[model samples]
Target: MEQVPLNPSRYPTVDYEEVMNSDEGVRKWTDNIYRWGFSLVDGSPATPEATEKLLERIAFIRHTHYGGFWDFTSDLSMKDMAYTTQELGAHTDTTYFTEPAGLQMFHVLSHTGGSGGASLLVDGFAAAQTLYREDPDAYNSLKTVLVNAHASGNEDVCIQPAAPFPILSHHPVTKELCRVQWNIEDRAARMDVDAATLVKWYDAARKFNEVLKRESMERWFQLKPGSPMIFDNWRMLHGRSEFTGKRRVCGAYINRDDFISRYLLLNKGREEVLGKI
Candidate 1:
């Protein structure tokens, strides 16, 4: 089966109350992510504890240097740029990890005395597919070239993958596009390729970046109180616009394997779902 990019105008949004109270609602919410890569739960409580509980219902929270569940404001609380008022380019998180986070949730608690903090999402699968169809050379470069990424914001703490990985990854058996890892900020500068290959890689990567930033490939929305958004980190690249004022956000990362396991069990007996994995 082929994967089509989401219809931007039709992004799923289910009621939080429904999800918390009914099994069918939970299946709908998770199914939306399985089919479209993201979904939103409206009417959720806008608090760190509430967010944590909601995420636990879906999968286990992945703990990193920042802890399992986090509540932070744009006050430079951490060494990462996400702590400041700046425009973050669209990219996936935890690129430095050998197994990057599977899913991410974000619920904006408050944004006062500020203007723009719109959330941005670009379907990496769509962009990569376009690259594959239009420029095979560039697509192949990204799929084959191995690169490094890291997280060194904490004092005396720098973490990176045990080995370098490629930007585009496919399923081993199905040969279907499964994961995408392209973070300009987190990607390290080191490479082992020759000068010619390096030049080709950069050119290819630049082209892919252009595709990712195209207007048709991007979706911009303001994450509001009572609306918690969850997205497949492996397929969607997320970012935020430059913002002012105090913006507090609460969220957590759910392990990929745990999420898939939940998705599989919830949709059991459906061959279409069970056969894919």
Candidate 2:
């Protein structure tokens, strides 16, 4: 795979300037993203321009129903809890969409006042592995059972119908862990499987959620302004703690394939050394 799995003890950080300026920066940052499914870019300019410029390094920003790139805060108009002070549980975004976002990038424009709103991320692959080893039966159910998800109430912004996807999905060929679809808020009733066995799937989901929430499995960090966080939407579950005062963030999503394609092209030569390993 040529990817280094994450070591939870140490946080991963890359230089924003380096990624925007140097070729080696592109290789290093992309490699880290491939390895960890997430990476932090420190020392970014606290401006909208920085966010746009940064995304360009990988590919064009993905224009979805949410718009290409936008800034969001405690705006009452938002249809989602993310715009409010509520603490969000660890979950993946856009689970209702058949082709959900592939990569998401966030640049904290500002975070002030009461001490909270720290970012939370759980390694889905790691959590899935834990489930496989500890409760193979539950893991099997999650890997095969289809769950329903829906998105609506934002008017023309989004009115997606409920979609079905296995909670534990893998790469079509590699059989590698791909995405963990776990969103409590967007989850609808499960009607994809036989009613008699539905309870078993729910039990598996509960156990998976328990593993995801285990204190040791989560990574929490206060992403203050000038710090940009980019993560694989498919491989990592993200959420935030409740906070007071102003907290604004600007970000966007890039198509998953585009991001992967860019990385493969930029790091093509470097693989010879990795191949030797």
Candidate 3:
């Protein structure tokens, strides 16, 4: 199905219980997530048990070198910006990995007394598609430009020296828009290309970013305590606002294949059950 980024007013919050217990709920949630790149889950508890059950309801957890589930609080030693008090612009996480986490979950266990700490989400795929439609040359340039991303350090090594990959890539089998990979924080500064193409690449990047920040495409909401959200990491770009006060978040990541598999299985099961009736 062709997906587009929509205003959150269209599909606000989804009930957590239905998604956990009802087959139809699973299908609808899957469809909504894939279509909109996100769904805010409000009916689930903000506990580890609830998060674990939610993952089980959809798909199993994806274990990486970062481990299964995460409990994050602001700290000086934070390797990632998600654990800091500073504001972040819209971007995908773990771009350094060869295949970054395809899905992300964030459970707000406690967000009391926090001001200016609301979370932001944007549809990166929508921005890319807009570029493709309006500026074909820039869109093609983005797909052709190869950039290096690194995620290794003293004790950990995922892809040493990084690997060169396109900012935009289509599925090999389906030849459909499969990945939109861009992370300014993780991007290697050494633009390993001729001057002319490098200029085009930057120009494309500017266009994409401009669309991503348009006010009409934004969804702003405060993540109060006990509200957990699950979103597609591949298609959506998320960010955070700077805040003062305590904020604790917990959740896990799931593989892209497993998510798609679960979605397919659930849809099939529903179809089969309905057909029998």
Candidate 4:
């Protein structure tokens, strides 16, 4: 077996042969490569049907409001719907939800015109760790505070009331600490903190965002006509670099537990084959 990089530029391309014929091999490969993130077989013409197959092969399929067919041209009205536009800042998808999807796959069907619209991915776990080491107090404050976020203009747009979640959390499967904060624009005012502490909290968060933006902790790539990028939404936060060209894509979400269950079941099958199960 070849050695895996600490951070791979792109996940190794494995044909269905490697993934289906030997469950053990697939488990071992995905475990290591996707510890932080991974991508699947690329270079094939991307389509909604192909995307569904890729997702079904792994485990249960999940969805958000953004799920299903979305055309960048006709969906101009959705631009204000949060995360509908091609221009997006670094954020974990649907952090406001009580239970955000653990994994996300974005399939790009076409990109006609776009300059600097490359997808940006940052290691949120790594970034949070850095903050914890440098500014423990700020980190603790974020974890303790309850963040409120709601869509403006549309009253029905407000969702799930307010929920308290740590900016940093332990991954339910990997047990690694990961960053969870998303949607900075809709964050409600902090009510518990005094004026001084609130100011400090905002400042710390601002600084962290700035550092994350400028830091070299990101890997960039443009989704070609036939490739889909699979990401660990809990551990990796993604965004677009902003582009004017027409970009059409479909996205779906899956839970972390579902991913682990599928992965472990495959591993068990492998172990049984090896007489170790």
Q: Pick by TM-score: which candidate is best?
A: 1
What candidate 4 gets wrong by more than 4 Å, as runs, is: 1-13, 16-29, 67-74, 79-86, 151-156, 170-179, 268-277
Regions of candidate 1 where Cα sits further than 4 Å from its true position: 1-9, 269-277
Cα RMSD of all models vs. native, in order, equals 2.3, 3.4, 3.6, 4.4
TM-score preference between candidates 1 and 3, better one: 1
lDDT of 2 by residue, 48-130 (tens): 88889888898899886667887888885667887788899999988888887888987889877766888998888889998
**lDDT per residue, candidate 1, 8-45, as tens digits?**
44568888878888767777888888887889898898
Which runs in model 3 stand beyond 4 Å of their true positions? Answer: 1-12, 152-163, 269-277
Lowest summed lDDT across 10 adjacent residues in model 1 is found at 1-10
Error of 2 at 8 (Å): 8.7
Question: Which of the two, 2 or 3, has more TM-score?
Answer: 2
What digit string (tens of lDDT, one per residue) describes model 3 on residues 132-190? 88899988988888888865542555443346788888888887788877678777777
Error of 2 at 215 (Å): 0.6
Q: TM-score for each prediction?
A: 0.94, 0.91, 0.87, 0.80
Candidate 4: worst 10 consecutive residues by lDDT? 1-10
Model 1 global lDDT (CA atoms, 0 to 1): 0.88
What's the candidate order when arranged by decreasing TM-score? 1, 2, 3, 4
